[model samples]
Target: MSRGVGLLLVVWLLACSGVHAQALPTQVSGSVSEAKTRLPIPGATVQVVRTKRGVVTSTTGDFSIEAMPTDTILFRALGYKSQRMPMGGIGLSQLVVRIQLVRDSVRLGEVQVISDRPDRAIINRALRNIKRPAPPVVSGAKRPPKPKPLFAVDSTAPKKPVPTIASPVSLLYDQFSREGKQRRKMEEIEAEQRAEKLRKARAEYNKAFLDNRGYTP
Candidate 1:
């Protein structure tokens, strides 16, 4: 085969194996309706989670979204249930879906969340706060000079705080030192016991030796 013919064959093979992107932008248009009542839901926000792009439903509950590669659209309508619908797997597929959103039942006993702490009836009853007006600002006037005591009868007042051996940690440290000293004394006592044992052993051997010599000591 000629070189040009081989190159042509290679190009044809490559084109056959590869897939091309949609030559134009694809649009997916749809209407949102209540699943239970079949009523149109207006102002619902629809999003393509895969592409992070979305659109809102119109007054008539109609919505149009530009489809992106590998997109799964999620729809959220207030007072109605959310929905998800998959579109176009790898290639552009024309889609016209009628999304059904059901109104969520309001369960009075269900757990409710608030952005900030709301005053509960139980808490409001427990707290009794008095609202006081702000004091007038004194800009230039000097605060009345604190009046001096009219009479100074005694220079000293009884100590409010009973003389605490202010250094409690120092006392603890001293107690720890005393305990350490006691531990060392106990160690010395144990050593003395071992030494006494040795002395007794020597005395017994000497007595035995004297007995063997036929001279009692």
Candidate 2:
């Protein structure tokens, strides 16, 4: 009976080793692409289902991950439907997988963009109202001659051509009118003042000369 128990224990150990060998992780490498176009999908997520093991595809849509035969591999990417494949058939050997993802066809709502454009009418009106600047004056340019006044007087007068004869009425008015008498009186008074000033000036000069000569009057 003890021999039989030893054989059963040995059989149980062999079964456990076989199971552990089958559960060993395998290096899985793959490329993901679009279903319709067959174009490579970079940055695609390659994750082992029911575990945290995952990897992201490279620019060439290539990925490498360690996964057990019992685990399921999930491929996900933006704008594409998710895909899953069981790793059981691949076994412990290194395998390269090519997965094609279908495009998600859920249409998005239309977007409206409003641009801030000034009104064309206002712009045209502003352009029309803009006053053009006057032409620039050039230096050292000859200027046009200025126009003369309507009633300009000439300073150069002609020689005597015709002498007007005064009438008796005009001659008597100049000699006896109140204005004429006042004017004659003013002229006489101006002449007397001039004579008095000249006499005083001549007397001062004679006195200065006699003093210089030591003469007494």
Candidate 3:
């Protein structure tokens, strides 16, 4: 009975160990960086070669994904070269990888673009063949002479007699008009002289006031 119990116990222990090994996940965690600078490369794609499972690196260029130990992980970025690394015999719990990607360069071929427009020689030839119209000619006929008068005519008429202020009333009216004009002219001249004098006096006062206050301007 003791021997049978020992055999059953050994079988049960083996079965539990197999179950634990099968439950282990095939996963990996890693970081991607630039090969030259060792700087983290974010937004890099980490995909399994034979499966649809993939993950993108975080801001720190760290990524984790589920993949078999024998499967390949591809890292791709916009300007960097693509890299493939096989997860060969890597432990599931302690798989820490640091992938460095090299830079990719693509050189384009030189292309010469030819225009479909006509050459300058062809344009000059077409212009030379064009015909231009001649200018119009003027008439040679002479103009007729101006007509002359038939009879002699008077160039001037007789002068009329000039009238003078012979009456007393007329003479008085003329004298009064002359005196009124003279009075108005004298008043205007006096008024202008008074204004000029006042302006000069005010300007002199302002200048003296400014000078007393020590103002140069």
Candidate 2, residues 1-217: lDDT per residue as tens digits? Answer: 6999999999999999988788778888989999999999999999998797799999989999988887899999999999998976455668788999999987989999987887899899999999999999999999898875433343443232232365667667767789877877777787688667656655665675645432122
Tell me how far candidate 1 lies from the true structure as C-alpha RMSD in angstroms.
Answer: 33.9
lDDT of 1 by residue, 66-183 (tens): 7754568899987767778776564555567799987877666877877676579756766656466899998898878876643333334222223247767755654567775676
lDDT of 3: 0.77
The lDDT per prediction is: 0.71, 0.81, 0.77
* lDDT ranking of the models: 2, 3, 1
Q: Choose the strongest candidate by lDDT.
A: 2
Over 47-151, each residue of candidate 3 has an lDDT whose tens digit, in order, gives 998896799999999999888656788999878999998877554655778999988887769999999999999999999998888876668966688765422
- How does each model score on TM-score? 0.42, 0.48, 0.43
Question: Which segments of model 3 are wrong by more than 4 Å?
Answer: 1-16, 19-23, 111-217
**How does candidate 1 score on lDDT?**
0.71
Give lDDT: candidate 1, residue 139.
Answer: 85
Total backbone collisions for each predicted model: 0, 0, 0
lDDT (C-alpha) at residue 151 in model 1 = 35
